[model samples]
Target: MTLNRRQAIAATAALFAAARAATPRGAFAQSPTTPEVRKAVLGYIALTDAAPLIIAKEKGIFAKYGLPDVEVSKQASWGATRDNIVLGGERGGIDGAHILSPLPYLIHTGRVTQNNQPVPMVLLARLNTNGQAISVAEKHKPLGARLDASPLRRAMNRESKFAMTFRGGTHDLWIRYWLAAGGIDPDGDVQTIVVPPPQMVANMKVNTMDAFCVGEPWNDQLVNQRIGYSALVTGELWRDHPEKALGMRADWVERHPRATEALTAAVIEAQRWCDADANKPEMCSIIGRRAWFNVPVPDILPRSQGNIDYGDGRRVENFPLRMKFWRDHASYPFPSHDLWFLTEDIRWGVLPSNTDAKALIAQVNREGIWRAAAERAGVPASEMPSGPSRGRETFFDGKVFDPEDPAAYLASLTIKKLAGA
Candidate 1:
């Protein structure tokens, strides 16, 4: 109490030091306004589902959330995205990507990685839902394959090549589901090939593929070019089905938890912006830029606006179930949705039949991170989901997948490539 000026200063400094010591180290780094790193390299394929990441970058949403130097680079294919994510940003690759929801699980389990090496990854958020399509070449247009693949079953054989982006990705799952619903065996009766999203229209033009399942604007482009007709938009198969997701290297996320939240928040905001009906034209124009998809607005806007010209003498204007980015809780990374992907992968022999889906989902899904980021993005509490599961989901073919009992759903399927079958 009677200390001199120097003594008082020393006592104050000591008190401050003690306070800092008492505070947890993570508390200081977890501030939403400050990130450990300002730059993060994120990859995206030239697909409409990637619109959120592109919008986040172009609209300065990332800068709004303390990440200004973030790079939204276009990846060539899902395979390339996987490879780059494995390389990470420091090695001239990416820290994250607009990826298939199942890809992170596959990579995390080393099922899709090189030499069976697991590259741990985190599912931060779902980029969008219900915008992908299964297209059939003009040659098969006469077969009249709509929601039912039975029409095309006559045309399918081992030589019939169907294309998807990656081995266990969403496209593969969708096409497989469609064929199976119509009693067409995807593995035994037809061949499924891998083709990049941007190359889909070109491949169809040359008859390189009999059909393909991919995200826009390829499906719309195929119709516009008269190369093929859409057998069905994936939404028709399963309305509001989860598609692309925002996934990151777990190491990068662990190294920069604050940055991870900021990145996710930015994307969430961009998703809201992208979902607005009024922003359709502007959003399409931005994504169609030469620096991005290099696609014309005509090719990208129709289906995105819920308008579709099936090219098989069927056109639906203002279709109710189209692409959803933020509305209907589209951006939430639901653990139940991830479980569906893992379960389907197992059904197709992509993941082992014995895989513990719930445990694996717990390991790879970052729904907690998504909730935090959603709050950071100023999402109103009312807009947030009350629970992780969306309850039981019903597909167009009348197959119901109850998240509570995936075993029953799997066992119900008549056609499957389960392990050792």
Candidate 2:
């Protein structure tokens, strides 16, 4: 006797409700301290990584934790997500967003948006990890451009342009690192442009860009459309690499602390639901609806189930390191991960060469808030790390990143545009 995905989800929801009802009044369920519950207008792009936010709203997780009026709206692009967050909920915009991991630091430092008017923001938790890829146009297949980007050098020499979602965001960093590792300078070797995730396949159809890096189901959609093939999944570049986060204005969090806790707890629970294998099929169906992604379920389900078809006659079933929402403490906002993002921004000359990485990480990463919410949500104490760092991480290229000495790591990079390096 086996239960289908929908049945499993129903069973899980029932168990969750029963547990809440059985608990004492003051134990697992407690009323929020904030009397006036404001609508939590949150923004998301049409990527599969936006699952936790969508699930929280659709499955009543937000309401369960006191954010009954939460509205998860879809944004047109990462750039739109950034501008709306800067404007905040009062000015016909969002209070927070499912954003690129580096965005909070970029906004806090005033490197992007306005005339250096820093938007003070806080990263409450990481949303998802490692479901992005570097995809090349189908024409490049003849050039033998799989993981070895050396073939791109020829195209770069001929005025080839590449696309990424944001200028100093995760997709940008992934493409830059991949190209640089192949001895090609992203700054000098190719022209890069910003194209939103949903538009990637359409743009490539018209030869808008030679290659691009973005989150799914766009990457998988490229294969379905027969326009391109994934040269490398970002997880192959750096396993379990942090991708997106739950970010909000620092002022908003301060004004509604209890609401903030509720929001974080709901997202954490949503992430847990998204990570469960049994819920993945339904998760894909929910997010693939016309109102959300406007994409078909076939385009979305493959990657969600760890099925990878590179569209070049290559496929891998049950690939272990696909997009992750909660397992491996994926939701924890490690300060070290923030530091790595800042370091990459500096490497690409996106941030000032003299920026103090440690102080900025401490100021912007609200892991304390995440811990409070996790504890309130009854996350096992053993799941939380004893310290801020996730320790040293190694990349597929065999290079190690030690968060303790970011400067040394920066200094050792062979390809960089750091101001005085």
Q: What TM-score, to 2 decimals, does candidate 2 have?
A: 0.91
**C-alpha lDDT of residue 416 in model 2:** 94
| Tens digit per residue, CA lDDT, model 1, 1-421 | 5999999999999998998899987676655458888899999999999999999999999999989999999898999999999999999999999999999999998898899999999999999989999999999888889999999988778999999999989999999999999999999999999999999899889888899999999999999998899999999899899999999999999999889999999999999999999999999999999999999999999999999998898899999889999999999999999999999999999998889889989988999999998998889999999999999999998999999999999999999999742
lDDT of 2 by residue, 1-421 (tens): 8999999999999999998888875465345444246478999999999999999999999988878899999999988998898899989999999999999888887879889789999999999988999999998887777667887777665377789999999999999998888888888888888998888999999997899999999989999989999999999999999999999999888888889988999999999999999999999999999889988999999988889999888899989889999988789998899889989999998988988889898888999999999988889988887888889988877778999888888887899998542
lDDT of each: 0.93, 0.89
All-Cα superposition RMSD per candidate: 3.9, 10.5
- Candidate 2 residue 9 C-alpha distance from true site, Å: 49
RMSD over all Cα atoms, model 1: 3.9
